[model samples]
Target: MPTTTQLVISGQSKPGVMAQVASVLASAGVNIKAFSAPEVTGTGKLRLLVADLEGARAALRGAKIRFAEETALVLSLENKPGALNEVADLLTQARINIKCGYCTPSREGKRAIVVLTVSNTEKALSVLRDQSLDEF
Candidate 1:
């Protein structure tokens, strides 16, 4: 799987703020895979996982949404039960801790896509892949 970094933006915590930001990404044909609003004081923070980071950033800027960039590990995992636990264990054994993680299954039950913010994703991927487990 191809890995890409996501951009996070912050702005006033008000209605329509998220909507407008989403609208820009939608208009740009950038699929939003994952998103969230982790609060920073009274303002809201927008986290976006998109296919076209540059295009999404441009659109957000055009829409006047203050934003910043950060790196994240994006991966697909088995959709069955215990799959998540196995992945976490593999990372733990390798000493590559997970900073944060989120997952959503596709329409079918074949796979669950997971995005992980980890201390060392490169090492984690290497370890998991050696075990024939999915990490990317």
Candidate 2:
């Protein structure tokens, strides 16, 4: 299985927080591939997969943004019923907890990419890689 580093940013939620972060990355010529931002109770969290990890890190550091980088499993699964459930079950059976996850919208006759942050990245990757999913 292949794994990629994902940046997780958490801070007090406020207007323009995401904009500022993106601006910093963009100024550094970093391209964001996948992103998710969810805010609750004045706190916000952002997760992103960047085309240039080093550049993004530098930009974040230059902007004084605190973030954590972790290994994430990216799976390309068939766009069909029970696809996600199968992955979830595989993780559950291994006692691996999913810390955070999101999937791209599935299109007809196409596969969907699911990005998962698991409690045990190596184990999850091993398990998923062993499966017959479209790709891991």
lDDT of 2: 0.87
Clashes of 2: 0
Writing each residue's lDDT as its tens digit, candidate 2 over 47-112 gives: 999999999999999999999988988888878899899999999999999988888955565787
Which stretches of model 2 miss by more than 4 angstroms?
A: 106-109
TM per candidate comes to 0.80, 0.91
Q: How many backbone clashes does candidate 1 have?
A: 0
lDDT of 1 by residue, 6-50 (tens): 687767787788788878889998888797675556776677798
Model 2 weakest lDDT span, ten residues long: 127-136
Task: Pick out the ten consecutive residues of candidate 1 with the lowest summed lDDT.
Answer: 36-45
User: After superposition, which runs of candidate 1 have C-alpha atoms over 4 Å from their true positions?
Assistant: 11-13, 38-44, 134-136
